[model samples]
Target chain A: MLNQLLRKLIRSASGRTQWLLAVVGLSIALLLIFAAVQVQVNYNDLLHGKTNQDSVANFLVINKLLNNQTYGNATLSAAEIDDLKKQSFTEDVGILTPSRFKASVQSYSDRFPFYTDISFESVPAQFIDVNSKDWKWDEQSAFIPMIAPNMFLDFYNFQFSFSQNLPQLTQDVVKMIVFKVNINTPNGVVSMNGRVVGFSDRITSLLVPQEFMDWANQRYSINQDTKPSRVVMRTKDPGNPQLVEYLKGHNLVTDADKTRFSKYRQIVNTVVNISWITGAVMLLFALLIFTLFIQLTVSSCKDEIELLVTLGASPKQLQRFLMKQFFPANVFIVLITLLIVTGLQYWVYSILSQQNMFVSAFTSYYTLLTALLILLVLWITNRTTIRKYVVQQQK
Target chain B: MQIRLQNVVPVPLREKILQRKSEVWNTNIVFDQGHWIKIKAPSGTGKTTFIHTLYKIRNDYSGDVWWGNQNSREVTGDALAQIRQQKLSIIFQDLRLFGELTARENIELNRVLQEPFYEGAMIDEMAEQLGVTHILRQRAGLCSYGEQQRIAIIRSLMQPFDWLLMDEPFSHLDQENTRKAAALIADECSKRKAGFILMDLDEDDHFNYFKRVEL
Candidate 1:
């Protein structure tokens, strides 16, 4: 009997204008929230360097800012290094060991007869991307393994080789080429065979083993104190705003590409923030519309509800009657929103896949969980509204 | 069930009752079980308000109303629900019927609230006796005022009530229809050995009462 009465009451109380306002507002809010979640997930992937094979780790290369007055003092001081080490984001910091000896290289291949003066810089083995065995050097070894930047080869192939009408060499071909490297140490002028082991996109300098660089620099350097001009830092979050602010405030220079990536990250963060605020506003409007609908329904049937209460009906009974009226509409709205969001997710996944971005189509389960949470909140709100109305009538 | 009102004075009627020192307004009264009573008042003297207070629907009165030993003010939610289901029933002056529902549906709401007090056929018989069986299929709002009054009377009688509180229930009914409705209520009250308080502006020969209070 109560169900019958509830059905009749619901039919009389339901208004199309209120329902349309609520549904449209809630749908917009849900869509915006879903879009925000998707954007944040993709942004996180990009920030973590998940999609690129040549992406750098959570590392940054910091160097002294060069100017006319600070050029001679550009070397990192021990005090400056200690300050960097004390940063919360800094996981590990290592100095770039500069070569203090004279080094020159001559290629043996007739296809590439080239000689150039080069400088070597060495860092910890963990920082380099090459194999440990290939990057090792000993005093008895006759050949020195070298790692050069991949950008150098790209430049030589695209600009230098194209202008000179020479055949472009692949990475495999370049690795097989041998060079005679001559180094002038304090003891004597030494000649060693050099072979390219690998190419790196992260570090820019020509890299040698730390052992070789240390031994050569100690033997050849005249100055006892040779400060480093560059530093490598492993950070917990390379995109930390505090780290960026700190670097800017100290007038330090990092890799140009890393700075560009940081800018892109900041833009993504701003977009996500704006989307969150917009979604929250939409949700607030939806809530207002929902509350308006409840108030309208309750006010329209105020006399009838009071009559029911006078006829031995409790507040809880009236709440159940109203819940039966509104609960289905709330569930339907949630279902429609979920369906639309799922379709949007699939479409976005296809678009991303077509562009060769390897992001997964499915977002985390929390999106639906959040929708369910919203539904629960709406249900609770509806119940509270009904209870308040019923209690008001009793007074 | 016995209802006790101790120095009861409704908030809105304070100036007229407490200040004027009306005899019945600030008096202690008790309506015990198995006794019919009448509260006669002039127009705008809080007749409906007094009935509402007895039904536990209004609480603005500055006094205590005890339902047996339990104060109405301190009745817990479950106890109130139980009282509404089995101990007390009311027929409002407005005959609060869902206009969208049929006449039978309004009565059936109370019938299904607890264990079946009257069989379905018995409800039809009562409707037949009250001359509303023809309009039972019609919506309560579409029915005439007299028809809606009969429906509300039948609905109140369908529930189990130790005390039936009526607020001018027969105001819209004519003599014949009012007699028919009052007979049905008295019959139900006699079967349950219950009593009722009928509030009105003037006295009528509806039932023999133990006492009458003038407000």
Candidate 2:
């Protein structure tokens, strides 16, 4: 019986054009908000170096700015390390342990022979982006696992190997080849077998495990000062502008890739923030339109509502009656908005993918969250409006 | 149940009722169960306002009205709803009917809100006695004033009540229709042993009253 009365009330009170306008406005606002949140999630994933397999570690190599003079005061001091550690963006800090002993590598193949004098450094295993069981060393081991920077291989393949007319090596092939390493210790020259375990894009140096560097430095070098000139920092947000500005202000230099990635991150953050603000403004206007629509509906139904109240209808009951008419409309609006957003997202993904960029085609979790948020707002507004109007009529 | 009215004066008609400064506005009255009472006053004498105040629908009045021990002014909204649903019912002077609904639907709306106070066939019988059975299918708004008044009377009687309040219920009805509507009301009140307070401009022979109050 109440349902019948409510239906009659809605039929008489609702203006079709006004209701359509309100729904369309709300849907557009919701669509924009959902799209913004989805884009933000995808971009955030991309900027964090997330891939299908593994994410690029948020790590940066910090060093003092170099000068023209040799032996310039470009080494990171202990005080400087403490200052970097004090930053909110810095999650963990580790120093790159420099090689104290002299080292040389030689490799011979059937078609080619290679020889080079190389510099070696090691950082804590946590700061190394490569994951390998061989990234550890012991004093009794005859072979040392090493990780070389990817850029070194790129340079070799592009410049040195091509000019020399030698065959280029893939990562798997490089990992299989062994090099004879010679270390000049205080006692004499010692030879050991070395193998490449993995490649790192974060740090540019040839890296051995910290354990091996510590032991080799103690057994070989005569110098007592073992202060490191470079530090590796793990930060929560590699793209933080404040960290970048702080580094620049202090005349500190980090890896080019780190600064480049930070710049990309800043752009992504700016886009996301702008999208969020725009979406929020649209949603606010949509809510205002919705409020006006509800006010008009209440005004049109005032007489019927007053009669119902005088006929022993409680405020809550009247609110429920009006809510029945609105709740379904809200659900329909959300569903339609989500459907439209999903289609638009696919179209956007297709456009972006054609440009050789890999962004997630859809962020289901964020989409669900957005839908839920819109529904909650609609429900609250509908209930509050009806309740307020019903209470007024009761008075 | 008994209703006690003490020193009640309608706010809008205070000066009219208290024109003589020496006159007293205070009065104590009680209507017990199964008692038929009439509140008689000409037009513009706050007759409807007095009935509304007694029904707990209007509170713009001084003093107090007590339903047994509960003050009418202090009744919570839910309590008032319950009172209207089961303890009290009213037929407004305007016959507040949903114009868009048929006469049967108007009465059914109130009938389904409460428990099964009257059987479906009983409503049909009452409609037949009140000469509204033929127009029961017609929209109440499209029906004549006299037909709508009969429908409103039937709708008000659909719910169980300890006290039924009527405001000029027979104003638009002819003598014959008024006698028939009064018979239906009296029969229902007698079945439940309920009291009724009827307000009108003049007394009539349609009901035997236990008391009369002038506002």
Candidate 3:
């Protein structure tokens, strides 16, 4: 009842259109801030979330630049490999050990006259993308198994076979054919049967099982220096700008197509930063307008307030009354902006999903938390301004 | 509460008042609790100033005014407001009611400003007895001087208080209207065992005065 009479005496701060304009400004500011937070969350989810995980984008074969300074000795030293492992981008690293012996591959079948001086490489089992059971080899096994690169097969089918006037071979047919692997030692030529077991796109080299590679190197290694010149690693995001920057700083190279997101990352960072700064400045101005409005109201009703204080109304009551009038608008702005962002998020999710991009349809918790934090700031502003003006009237 | 004055003198009226003989100026006196007091003064004798000094509205006075043992000047701000709401009530000579509000609203303002001291119907009852019921719904600014005076009297009576300060509260009313208004004031004070210091320019038998002084 007292507040009703007080309300009649002190109407909502005089300028209605200005108040509405300020409210609109506050809403737009809140929307921009919310969009920045949601965009960041979506970008992070795309980079690391399992639903959008790209298997081929997580592993990379890293090697130093083969320039004049490192042409013959491009091998990563133990310290360099350890430093790469210690970097935040590299989740796991496996060195690619090259064959240490003289070797060649020749066809054992009479129908196919295929022979080539081929070198083999071996990597740890964790780094291999194919999971064939025949990938392991021992002296008792029927034939040695090798994992061939899909690029090699594509080249043979599309260009190599047409130029050489030879028949193209599919993966299944190639896997069935056996070949003889010859390793030259001090005594004589050692021969073993070999067959293609699987195909992979992650690595380009002909890969042999680690156990077989170790045995061959132990028995027939002539050039015994086996320092690895290449390494493969698994990471959360191959497109992370930090990873690209690290690679560039260390004079290393990887496939350009996989790290293509660095450009988009930089653009998104600029956009988010611009949105954040603009929103904060606008929010500051909106709050300033509100504070000035509150001051104007209190000053305009200065006589009435003095009479009220003279009539025994405490400053706390007036402060509470002013807060009740102003804070609800802020809360309403925050809620409406949140609803708009939610709608935009769902729309973005549907549009992106049609193109095979996966992102959450709901606003992320971090965005909600940021909204709550902004609301807290608004609440404090409302409380502080009301108290200051009301107490000023008292004085 | 006991009202004590310690060499109380209004600074603006100090020079002229010191040359004259007065009972309240530069004099120490204690008006006991529940005592009806009257301060009579001719025109331009600072009657309103004395009332305002007691109410602590203007503090350009020389000496201390105490409510019980607490000095009036020391009891300030919200504490003073609290005392005005719960311990002291007043009726200014100008009838300082909010002009925008109706006469009834003017009374209701005082009633609701604190934990209400009377039921809402008491307002209508007081308005009826004071002969201002017809103008209760009229704005105080639109009402006649007599009606506004009666409205101010009822408004002052709406709050609980130990002391009621009146400065020519019935000046604009007729003899009959003044009698009715005074009867109502006296009745309300008696009901609460409260007292009042009515400062007027002339003598009148408003109530059985416990003590009377010339200002």
Query: TM-scores, in order shown?
Result: 0.81, 0.81, 0.89
Alpha carbon lDDT at A335, candidate 3: 93
Task: Supply the DockQ value of model 1.
Answer: 0.42
What would the per-residue lDDT of candidate 3 be over residues A1-395, giving only the tens digit for each residue?
88888887787767988898889889999999999999999999888888888898888999998899888888899998999999998999999988888889988766777778888999999999887888898989988899999999999899988987779998999998888989888999989899899999988899999999999988888877878889998998888889999988998888888899988998999999999999999999999888888888888888888888877777777787788878888899999999999999999999999988888999999989988999899989889988877777776
| Model 3, docking class | medium
Name the best candidate (by lDDT): 3
Candidate 1 to truth, TM: 0.81
Question: How much is the lDDT of residue A108 in candidate 2?
Answer: 57
lDDT of 2 by residue, B1-58 (tens): 7888888887887898777321123477777888999878778777788888888778
Model 2 residue A313 lDDT score: 68
lDDT of 2: 0.81
Instruction: Give the number of the best model, judged by DockQ.
Output: 3
Top model number, TM-score: 3
TM-scores, chain A, per candidate: 0.84, 0.75, 0.92
Error (Å) of candidate 1 at residue B98 is 5.1
The residue-by-residue lDDT of candidate 3 on B1-215, one tens digit each, is 98999999898899989999999989998888789999999988898899888988889999899999999988876688788998889999988878888898889989998899999999999998997889988988899888898998999999999999999998898889888999999999998899899999888897999999999
- Candidate 1 vs candidate 2: the TM-score winner is 2
Instruction: Give the alpha carbon lDDT tens digit for every residue of A1-395 in model 1.
Output: 66676556544346887688888988888777877777777666545545632347466889888988677788888988899999998888988988877889988778777888888999988788776466789888768888989998999899988887878989888788888998877777788898888998768889989998888788777566788889999875676677887887787888655555566677878887887789789888888787778777888777777666656666777778778877778788778877877777777779977877655577646677878888888888888877776676666
lDDT of 1 by residue, B114-202 (tens): 78688877779999999899999998889999999999999989988899999999999999888888888889999999999999999
